[model samples]
Target: MTPETSDNRTLPWFARPAARTWRCPPAPAAVRDFHASLPDYAPTPLIELPVIADELGVGRLFVKDESSRLGLPAFKALGVSWAVHRVLAERPESGDGAAPGPVTLVTATDGNHGRAVARTARRLGLRAHVFVAEGVHPRASAAIAAERAEVTLVAGSYDMAVRRAAEAAAAPGVVLVQDTAWPGYERIPGRIVEGYSTLCAEIDEQLAAADAGPPGLVAVPVGVGSLAQAVVTHCRSRAAGPSASALLSVEPRAASCVLDSLLHGEPVSVTTGETTMAGLNCGTPSSLAWPHLRDGLDAAVAVTDADSDRAAADLTALGLSPGPCGAASLAGVRAALGGEGADGRRATLGLGPDSTVVLLSTEGSEANPVRVTGT
Candidate 1:
């Protein structure tokens, strides 16, 4: 199926009067400590883009580059490593100081998350089983396999892959470490979402070191809304200050489940299609993530593949190698800050000339490459 194109005059956007109140616990210090203990672990770069900021009419622009996070090409390692460690740590060890039996980590992914799960399994001497949808790229599947994981290709969408992975995880010694959550399967997914707080924590310190105050606006690309949930949790908390930092979510127009859900006032599944932004091609919002998103998001926007491609090209010209998923944040910012009725939209979003902005560039080109025009 082909992706949908947004109206050049106006992009799809939803806004609320005041963000609903949602109490989210701050990320524990242990999460950061655990991530720091990993091999090659370090905080990713928070690059300041003065040129882009001027173009976007914002005071400052920063992109938290997650391209080379912990030796992975994407930010999934932050969540996967912590969740896997927590799960394993909570397991009952036999008196012999060993697990009772062999354990296998299982999950479904469009790309980066699966590879992350496989890497964790390989590091811990456990097995990994990764299920991918039919549309997943060959390089993604191969990457998972390269990590010594047993890769299964599900003949459907990412949602179907998740179902198949869940079924497989029903067996003994197999744990489903999926990032998305459904009823009766909330615990591990919650842990996965909490694990993402490490990224937010890093962003805080990086921004502080640069002498930048809290961002006035933060854009995050959403896929099943896990990372968005983490962003909302960090940005909306009292400790982050009651600063009016509007959280914006970006999704592929063809797979905008989060936007659809927000419009409907409930979590609703949509029909997803192939897109260059493979990592954000989810058809449903995670059940566990929906509440926080519903309450915490200031706005949601959907961008077409063309929009993301252009944004990617622009970032590349500026010496930033962002994948389609990563560039989606910039696409969303343009949609929100430009176009018809943009003045009113900007006013509502509290965006102004001196507003600080941060775009979460969640992946690098190696995760999902796309040919951008003029690049």
Candidate 2:
């Protein structure tokens, strides 16, 4: 379907085939190797959802449960912690063996990323400055502050806070560890993306141990596309895995920048109005992740706020109480397999009864407290 086919309704949805064949690349050895030394390092669970698979009429369903990652409620800790470590480790003064007094890690976040950054900073004996957009949930802000990070509330959208964070990081003794990248600021964000490869690696290991063949279709939640890109890279790099696994990219209907970027053949910003899936409510795709998404995604779908809520409830009923963004992968799967034009789209991607689907449950329901309904 074309980009013009959106109705923006109670469960507004859209899908289109990828323009190129998706291929994964090798995971970054440096970042993955370093994360192994961190005390909090451990593989999150890859939970089998037999009931959901039965409900969806698929062979099997699996969730990469990231609700408790490195003591944080979200998987953002994986990336943020690694990025902060990389930034500090590379500092010239860091090698001199003197105390790195009062170094500050800075970033803009809707919630989880900032909290993770703050927690990482505090753990590493550094200060943190987190810029959050207006309308960020109180729990998320409080969590960041609890980690001793200074939280600054920007008046406009998340993109605005990103700008402010960039300005602040320009100060001496401050380092930016953002997940999104623009021109001329790619290194740190690049490391952040690489840091996320740990999740995919863990998922692969868990699946192997369970003797579950690689997922035939992997549905990933997309915001700035960093996590999805890392997944694609790791999956592609594996020598013995589902190299043909179809990647289904999901995002909030209100902030479908990756979908829009795919449709437009370039990274185009969208208007990020309020959305229940705050983590997926990014108006712009990361410049560092755009090429990966463009070349490595098999299909794209956008889910409405109601879809997110319902999916969250469904997962909670299955004993996985996920946040809105975390549940979006299931919502996208529902849309792709059961919603409008599902049959044709499924046929196009070769999804069917024998297909195994995997969804990345990227967070728990801790940060977001609001409940939205389908009207």
Report backbone clashes per prediction: 0, 1
RMSD per prediction, one decimal?
3.8, 3.3
Q: Which ten residues in a row have the lowest lDDT in candidate 1?
A: 1-10
Tell me the TM-score of each prediction against the true structure.
Answer: 0.94, 0.92
Q: What is the lDDT of candidate 1?
A: 0.87
Q: Scored by CA lDDT, what does every candidate get?
A: 0.87, 0.82
Could you give me the TM-score of model 1 versus the true structure?
0.94
lDDT by residue (tens digit), candidate 2, 266-356: 9999998778898877899999888888877778888888888999999999899799999999998887777456677777666779788
Model 1 lDDT per residue over 1-375, tens place: 112223454477887647734456666778888888776888999999999999999999999999998888999988888898889878997899876788999999988999999998998999999998777778778889999999998888889999999999999999999999998998888888888999999988999999998888999999999999999888777443335588899999889999999988999999997789989989999999999999889889999899999999999999999999999999999988886777877876788898899999999999975422111
